[model samples]
Target: MAGNKQPVSVLVLLYTAQGRVLLIERADKPGFWQSVTGSKEGQEALLATAWRELGEETGFAAAQGVLHDWAQSSVYEIYPHWRHRYPEGVTHNTEHVFAFELSEESTPRLNAREHTAYVWLDWQEAAQRVFSPSNAVAIRELGRRLSPLS
Candidate 1:
């Protein structure tokens, strides 16, 4: 029997206090860059999914810095090519957003199977560089959070 499809996932925006965001090029898809993302395994909490994905994908653990749940979500259709990962008839996924703010830029150990390389860029460039719409939305939201309130 196929496992239950997890509708919840996490999209973690890793950034520096200076407002630089980290983006990784996907190994499976050349030129496609994105932040850390993954679905919850079993019954893990949403935040746990974020932390686990961050550590798994980038070697950055949220325990060392500020990890804020933006309390935002986006539901979108799962791409046709990658739909096999989910159970049958699972066509959509809801991604919860989180941000990990570091004091300075740090080296990230990329999982070669998942990513080719990683780069840190200013929020604007990062937003434009990411391929996924939900990731771009998270980056824009991060910009808003970091902006001054006047």
Candidate 2:
């Protein structure tokens, strides 16, 4: 699969203790908002994928804050328009989930090539704004995870 992408991906929910989650508008799909996400490169651990995507998409480093592996994965059908990036027969993707907490509210350095704009919204609003069901679920989960502590 010379030009094929790995079916494994990572979804990083970037949030603050106050439950504000960061979402980026995709350059490819202007209205589509999502958390930090990207496919895994050959042999890379899912955690590494999450860290790489976080930096690549938001210019945020895992070392700068708390990055937690939520130990969750979701299998979903690949979007038809984006399926061409994967092997011809690959129709599904497994996305691992991670949660990153910033020390406080901070602006994300958006990657213009992948994302055109960024916004920080309340976790509930962020969940509603995301285009992917899985991404939305992760945002809501982040809220649940923080509720007890808040």
Candidate 3:
């Protein structure tokens, strides 16, 4: 826990049944917005990491709504500035994807330390607003999943 950040993480996309998606602006990076995301700690399961991040970032627990494990993961290079959080040789992260769908639109009680603002937008708009490509892809997939027809 002290030497390096885990290379594994979870990315959670919070959305409504009607396809509205939530995005949070990073406190440290201002305009850099994304869905719920954090690295796994200890031996935590990916599902647990998803729920923990969801609660930490949005104050929403898995029991409050439906949490779907998309069973998908992405590997990407860690940004340079954030690399110090990880081990010296760690240049990439593997992010598991999850989806939380609320019955309706609702406000999120954000963690001020991690995020400064939050927004709920149409899936398309949410996808466009996110600074992370993986977050955008998850949003678009949410849109496709909630569409009238597959």
Candidate 4:
């Protein structure tokens, strides 16, 4: 699989039922906050990617609560520094969106190699705080989905 394209990844917007979103600062880029995100390993399914990344990056297990597949995907340019992880000609990635709602607020044990810190913010503030356009789009979608009916 060395030269094969990296499978699509998942971006899980971890939030509370009350609409607070979780944002984790990237260890590689301090002050850059985002939700759980990672590529699939081998032939693993995309949902599996979401579950695995959640556990690996934040110590959260999907079975313990709600994890919904938003059935949304976005393609965006792969940041230059991380492009080497994908195939030579691949310059973009398709990220599937998911949501994890915890029963209540909880502290995440971040993977120090991947993230520097974590915060819970109101959805609007979370959307503004995310660094990636695709990530921000996903946050907006989450807001729309969770908003109460008029």
Candidate 5:
């Protein structure tokens, strides 16, 4: 799938009721921690893309947890370093946000090809640790979601 990623993608944030967010360190770009993320396939539903990416990147099957589509999306300029993954002239992408809530933080079967390390941190700290702006935004939003009254 080299240089063929769709401009539309999914960002699945796996968290617990306690607000601990799961973050994975990218293998190709170590120290870049993020939630499960990937591009959509042709004509695929955004929900399906989220589920697929969840399993592929973190080994969490759809049946293992319930996915919540926050119905949130953000369009941003793609990072120059990874822009080659998309077609020529494609400089931006729309990322749809989804979330999977677990009762507790569980060990995920991390895909070594994509990630080298994993950590579960409080939403605030996770938000600060993510490298991508959009990813950080999503994580920060997680706090609001878990505590809409706070």
Candidate 6:
């Protein structure tokens, strides 16, 4: 119906040269962890959405990090609990993946109503720690790209 969200979203994973990935705890879901993610507002471009969400969710400065577009996308079913945020009959979401390379691990000012805490862990650990399968896969993919063996 009207006043519902589009099913397009962005997932921005922040990582460092040391392969540490940042994971944030959701304020609403306590233990549920994820990278910075949010839906595209109206007709916003994907890059704009990425930057908007990064700043909105983590208080990260737009000019502070190197942002990379993984040129990857995933379509997954929206969790039942969050379906209400989208329009009627919208069961799936198309998430574009990106990564921000930080020079080093840094603390983020979490949005109190969106996220409560943050942790920086090894890429593998972060992949396993995130609540969404797609997010996990993206982190693992980042690991593979950053790994010497890959």
Best by TM-score: 6
RMSD of each: 1.8, 1.8, 1.7, 2.0, 1.5, 1.2
lDDT of 5 by residue, 1-150 (tens): 348889999999999989999999999998999999999999999999998889898888766778999999999999988998998889999999999998879999998999999999999999999999999999989999889797
Among residues 3 or more apart in sequence or in different chains, the pairs in candidate 4 whose N, CA or C atoms overlap within 3 Å are none
Candidates in order, TM-scores: namely 0.93, 0.95, 0.95, 0.93, 0.96, 0.96
**CA lDDT scores, all candidates in order:** 0.89, 0.91, 0.90, 0.88, 0.93, 0.93
Cα lDDT tens digits, model 6, 70-121, are 8899999999888888888889999999999999998898889999999999
Worst 10 residues of 4 by lDDT: 1-10
> Can you rank all candidates by lDDT, best first?
6, 5, 2, 3, 1, 4
Write the residue-wise lDDT of candidate 2 on 5-124 in tens digits.
999999999899999998999999989999999999999888889889999998898567899999999999999899889988899999999999998878888879999999999999
Best by lDDT: 6
- TM-score of model number 5: 0.96
Error of 4 at 128 (Å): 0.3
lDDT, model 5, position 8: 99
Q: After superposition, how far is residue 131 of candidate 1 from its true place, in Å?
A: 0.7
Poorest lDDT segment (10 consecutive residues) of candidate 6 = 1-10
- Winner of 2 and 5 under lDDT: 5
Report model 2's TM-score to 2 decimal places.
0.95
Steric clash pairs (candidate 1): none
Off by over 4 Å in 5: none
Badly placed stretches (over 4 Å) of model 3 are 1-3, 148-150
